[model samples]
Target: MTDISLEETIRSFNNTGYPFPEDKTIHSLFEEQVERTPHHIAAMFRGASLTYRELNEKANSLAYLLREKGVRPDVIVGILLERSLEMIVGIFAILKAGGAYLPISPAYPVQRVQHLLRESAAPILLTQTQLISRFSIDPDEAEVIPIDLNGPVYTYPTLNLQPVNSPHDLVYVIYTSGSTGKPKGVGVEHYSLVNRLNWMQRKYPISLTDTILQKTPYFFDVSVWEMFWWSIVGARVSFLIPGGERFPQAIIETVQTHSVTVMHFVPSMMSVFLEYLRNSQSDIQRMSTLRQVFASGEKLTVANVRAFYDVLFIQNKTQLANLYGPTEATVDVTYYDCPMDDSLLHTIDKIPIGKPIDNTQMYILGENGELLPVGETGELYIGGVGVARGYLNNPQLTSERFILFNPQGLFLQKPPLDPAKTPDNNPPLTESFKGVQGGVFQKAHLLYKTGDLARWLDNGNIEYLGRQDFQVKIHGLRIELGEIESVLSRHPLVRDCAVIVKQFSQNITLIVGYIVPKAENVSSGELKEYLKNLLPEYMVPNMFVIMENFPLTPSGKVDRNALPDPSGLFGTKK
Candidate 1:
């Protein structure tokens, strides 16, 4: 079917990764930027602004207060806040205090928030006064600190705190939906973030005058680079008001007002944003200042690429880079800078998720663990410095997903690490993150088995197909169907349920919940409201199907293929 061989594909896709200084912390690098440009505006929200010096001093004040509260390296401190100056201040404060800040969005359901707090073993939580009352916090379980830093915070010294976190120490823990019907925390260490940030800075060099629009929610790992990237190079970051990301006009206005040069969008949102611009004549002209637009979280489709060019790229010299990776692999691993030329549409059909960034390796492996040749679809295994420490407090799940690959044979049958060789007492936290440096782990590298299907194209770029499992990406959210089904089945009137994604033409993807009710009747409205209390709004099915009985296969498994197509039968959210 294809001319390219296995050897050529492997050599082309995998980058010659270099070693990064493994002993550095994320904040230490940020501190250097502060000394260089202390008075430059670091972040802007609404009309309020903070210079590098002011932001640093405020973060330092909170850091001192947090340190006194026993926050230290590897300690998980919860931060639940709406988008504001305090939200930015709180994130830096947690890092400066030598703690991994777990980003908990204010939009999260109370039950979901409670689960994260409990599962993470969080000791201290930082939140605004408006958000603190939403959660019923136990003093013994976790101490809650309302993030109003005016009263006593200013009394503490504004000097930078001495570094304590090691390269191995976790900088953040992002909770993603788990296939096992629960949310699992993925702890990313400092070195991994440093590698990701370094690659971003070098590959896409933005000037000090360039302003980056920070709109993605902090709960997602995409926001990690958005929050910290500008600080390193002294670039300005423009933050949107809470929930402002949903408004296209606001985003365009912000870009035009700030001259925002860099920003990111989920592929679905890109379509929505482009669609908005297509309909609006004036708004499209206002978005001319955008330099590099990033597309991630979902598949970068042909339509998305076309929409980008039709809306802005053709008129302005804006570049749309399709970035691909899982949250497990620090934000993004591969990037394809879309050809700025107008002729790209006629020549190229689907955009390829480009080659691995610096210090990263992408391998396409067959079912039997053989190296997949060019054009052959296989599971994508990512390795290198960007790989995070496995899920926090989830050894079994960590062992299942993160494994050492054997290029010679089948994958290592057992867990990647030996108990005796593990330096950390916690086995899950001891993944060989630094092993991939300079390809030392050619025999066995610590790689995250991204369940997404992909293949190596002729010229070295990787083409993402779709998920190999139950996980689906909707509006840039990586959702586990099992997690949704688990929550749906828990309803008092629901007997059993199956969650699936329904896709039609023009990228109309919707979450569909097929339920067999326990009671005589359970209204769709009732089910929706109940699920909204337990799961995030996006996880809730856009439509509900009341099935008398689910069609099953010979083995008594729910035959998803036999499930009715609800396209015309029901109208629901897109």
Candidate 2:
């Protein structure tokens, strides 16, 4: 199709009846892609690259090896690796072995990581020799399989393991930082993943000639899509080492070197990229080969968005977007292909995440569960294939968040089994679940209560109004204070901890952790040092406060409301 025709086709399809794949299971799609493009470049990590043929063979071999070791269908396996060629192999190998992969970031606290591994009951842990010390459990407790990409030294046995994924078979369980508690594992089914991958390929259309880049840690769900989707299309997916934060220059070099046509980044990282491009010695402004630039994880501010088009898109004519969604939804639910018209620039306050992608349906609802009319403010509830099955072992919390509703009846009901057990046809929960009466509706429509607040614009797009809770965005990163508290409370020196999103500036929110130390002698510097090893640098609190006792509210709860503001207490205002 001609360029205009292709764009028109995509727009028309989305406007009319956008056809999604019937087989939602990842196994079938994975098999089909491997069969169709065996010799095409499936993925690239630094100097190492794998063709579809090699990836399939390697996965098949690992599958057989895993089965020989007695790993079976429905089993969960922990994958602890950085963004590398081996990580991709481990994922497909787990799926091929009829098991699911649970991504555990090596940077996570050993205690929390161990909690997730034990909570999920994953039987095997996959990692590299460099990360062997991060495993929290004894090797004897669960199988620890260290991937020796360079020195396995022997051919792996080959076997075509029949795909055993029921429509509900688990694919991967990703633990999102919990704002109110420890990190909770969000379980995604094979079909949900398949639907997402299929939709992404159809919408984004990365091809054999496209070279994609995997920048996020493998533990992040977006990385999962980065590796597999490119594999399906025989596209090259380059890897950025973990230090891409410190060496944005190297990332630019890699993109230039590989002639990368497609890349994904969080808004914070995109800022870093745009900053690097503006200041760099390399004339990135002239590199017109880059085609697609996708950003998510946080809103793309007006200034940053404009700077992006001025430099990146003006040069490359690339697609720029503010893709939106939480991990509970599969990577993204909506995308707004950014507009570049100068006339519309002044009126664009917030880039709308645009419409729901493919099968996903979004509802703006009032506090009472009623569907807010257009131009009304309400919480955003998402539905359809992009919605996750639910949290991995926390049924109460899952049921609380993922509700069932009937659009026609406007009723809400608590789901009985895991939603994964039920098909999507349980009923269409189109309206928001509100009030006590909302509990009676039980068709198949699963309602995902996104904590985000949004309002419909007169133009039919939704504008995000930030969060209703203490949750806040820092450096364009979405963080839940509960998640920080959960991780901090686990520290031996911390007797009690409270984490809150304290905004020091209009653009900056710092994670302020207030801790009651086990002893009076603990120092804030020492606590920061301890957290540096236990969590991702972003998750580490920017400032620490040691308190002998927390203020109490009338309700007898810790009075977080009474805590001194960071600007006043710390003398550090953003």
Candidate 3:
């Protein structure tokens, strides 16, 4: 095999999707929209709407109070609240006060919330009157400011507080699920987030008349794009009321009532919503106002894509986009627009994750860091501007995952450059930088190892194979659980499914499946036969259990840990 030059390989996979100036921070861009469309509705929750000016003023008031309490550059502020207008305000206020906001979801367990508060070490916390009692922290440890206390904090005058940080300063630190049984905080700078938001606006423009639905919890990175992207473009953001996410009818009604044009969903939730549409016999025309639907956080199966196309896009002009990214890549890094052609849909087993977005580059690398060929499967590494600033307070873990990559030996001879002097400089060194203080200054470019197995297609698209760790070996044959789940999802009666390896003994393990059936009468025997046709016998699950609904994490993805053990269950034989 001929060796491909590093420059050629980089040029082949890099995507300059849409270019936008990165000179401004999120707060500055949001203020520009406020200046242009002060009267436009910026956000709405529970029958209350705040114009751009009103929202800015509320945010400014909170910022003023925060500044009085020593919130400044490099400071970390915690936000604990429900899905309400104040939650949005808290986000902007933290940015305006020159601090990185740590979102603590109200739905999280008390111990988990306490862990985040203690791990992040956020000296200041913003919460409402109702949620103040939920915190397990002592008042002496962190100053708690309740926004709805009917005090001067709420009635304080609104003023423009000049942003004190540069584009590279930390904007937010979001905690994602870690395999080590603890949540890791990913610190994303303003420049990385602004680039993502600008690309979304350019690719799928949201007009002032459009309303975006904010149903995901604020703690998740999906909400980062959903809540702020619309505001940056002067579009209205409609918040979903409490308990609304569990009920499909409530979401549908909110979409119809607000004429929501844009929305995002995890594939599991999307499957449920589509099932609701089919079972209720609802008119697709009523949902015609929805022009674009974005799916991410999980694999978008071919069957779910086809169902969405047949029910929503077949007679309307809506477009379904399949996005792929982890929390470390700032929400999304790649996108694929599902075509309406049934022939094309039938031929593919799994939808391609599509091309990289603007200022983003993806590479499939072998175990030894060599570039893999188009059809060869390897681990996916993300580079370019969207790479996060590494995990907060965990430098060893950060250095392990966020590696330095110089494909062409371009920086081999150059001396180490200070991170503070880099063109896109982040905040000054903090506790998170303790372990890497001396070494990080020498790197040329940081690439985040996604730990996901994928391969490049001939058409320049990437096909995601499941996580590298999710690959299991049974009876000397390596199997990809996602492949099995994909085949099961294609069955007419299977709405969603999850596959796990259950170890019955020290040397023996069995593949078990948990499924949510579309029809009550669907049988596991039929699903086993369906799998036999599509997958090898070794790859097929040994047992199948039907569930009314799969348990979900706070981020809306299927919770694998909550799956019940298949004890005293009979195995299916081929």
Candidate 4:
């Protein structure tokens, strides 16, 4: 670890270049847009468009109904519905009512949905008439409001209602995959969401003329921006019809028909879509209206970048950018716009995840919590305004992940809290501020420890290596699976690949490679030789399995857990 002073470390990590509004909430920002352009189309779904005025009225009606059922600030309301107009209404209503919305996808297993509902301890659940029957919950446990059936019956004022939420109040709780079997809910506050939107407006401003495609599920954190960010800037948000999320043709047609100016995709889905365009010889000219494409949720490979440049950017002036952030950070913390140069893309092994966004700070820290110097790999710790309020209903895990560090001297004067304004049954806010390096000032800000491993580059960009736990030990030599996968991805015949450690017995373990070949009749022998020439003998996978396609998680990420075990055919390592 570098022997940098505490004050120096604070200066190094703080990204104060871009400014963000501290007093605004997501609801307040959207209301301003609604007031500015109430007649403008806010969102479109299946040939039907909802104007800002209509959307606000629908949300206001539901918000009034929710308030009648005792929903208020910090309260978690469950929202179980598919992608539709009602889904968007449910989200806005929850925020307007000053309650955090807990999104549960109706497609999720009954048990998983029930677990999330119970875990959130939501007082009310908003769903459509069809999904209301899918959930098996007692009436006394939580109030179920069917938006399609019962919402229109109740007459509530559709006029603009002032949101009764503080900046620090909870806005939403999104659950992410946990190391353990259960998913952990991350509670994001209005301040963080507002900061993110404000930064986006300054960096990549969207206008009413721009139409953003909303394909991501509501349960995912990215959907937060997809649903509300456009509304803040008076832009139109176009939704993908049900069953069209994974279909490339459907996505392309929607973009062409709706003239979508902005869209986002995970690298895995982007690769598939690019391949569809290449193979089908689709009319890429139709998508000339697209202005930007954002890739995140997984590592964006160089090949995928090249594919976008050659297939998409070459024909049109669409900007392809790589965004990096976990669910803990409100959507994205950093972004890198890919330059249209093949030689430059070929030279670099991985695209940089870029510098911190407005008001967000990124620090590469060693295992012992010491900040590492540039060019050295360490655990990535995120600090600043985007840090969430911590995990919901899991204080122990929250404390373990969210650390306290006050680099700035803002906490010197403590502010008074109003007991009546605070949530009645919510967990008490805990103060765990320890002085920085035993300094006189004892104030500390919360920083989230992202278990991801990364290194600061000479150009000030951060190169994400992989997860710390993703490192696997084989034959007494620890190996980073990402390093091997990165090398394999460069192979001309390999379209996509993933590396995993398979255990056949207590004493026998083997590193296996799963590959999606680009050409027919490609054998494991060719790939083995290709890897051996570039990697050490031990680094090479013990076996290679050619896969037609890798299974994907609900979030469109490569699902390692769903990978089939090859132990049955390959017995053990020779």
User: What C-alpha root-mean-square deviation, in Å, does candidate 1 show against the real structure?
Assistant: 6.0
lDDT of 4 by residue, 229-295 (tens): 8988899998999768879878988999888999988776788778778754456777889889988
Model 2 regions more than 4 Å off: 1-17, 134-136, 285-287, 407-443, 475-478, 486-497, 503-509, 516-519, 529-537, 547-574
Model 1 bad stretches (over 4 Å): 1-9, 19-21, 149-152, 407-444, 504-507, 567-574
User: How well does model 3 score by local distance difference test?
Assistant: 0.79
Q: Work out the TM-score per prediction.
A: 0.91, 0.85, 0.78, 0.77
What are the lDDT scores of the predictions, listed in order? 0.83, 0.71, 0.79, 0.78
lDDT score for residue 223 of model 4: 78
Question: For each predicted model, how many residue pairs clash, with residues at least 3 apart or on different chains?
Answer: 0, 14, 0, 1
Put the candidates in lDDT order, highest first: 1, 3, 4, 2
Give the higher-TM-score candidate: 3 or 4. Answer: 3
**Tens-digit lDDT track of model 2 for 1-574:** 4645533433332341233444445655666777888777777767778787787777788877777777666688988887777877888888888888898777776766677778888878888878987565766556787775774711676555776666567788888767665677888777566657766787888777888778767667777677677766667777777667446677776777777887787776677667768764355743456788878777778877887876776666777877888788878877788887656766777788777676666778788876665566789988765678888878999998897755443322322222543455333322222232544443236878999998766555667878888666665455677776776787888998887767665445678888888998888788887776656677889888888888889988789988767666755568
lDDT winner, 2 or 3: 3
- lDDT digits (tens) for residues 344-394 of candidate 3: 888878899999887677888898988787889999998766889999999
Flag the better candidate by TM-score, 1 or 2.
1
Which of the numbered candidates is closest to the native, going by highest TM-score?
A: 1
TM-score of 1: 0.91
Candidate 4 scores a C-alpha RMSD against the true structure in Å of 12.0
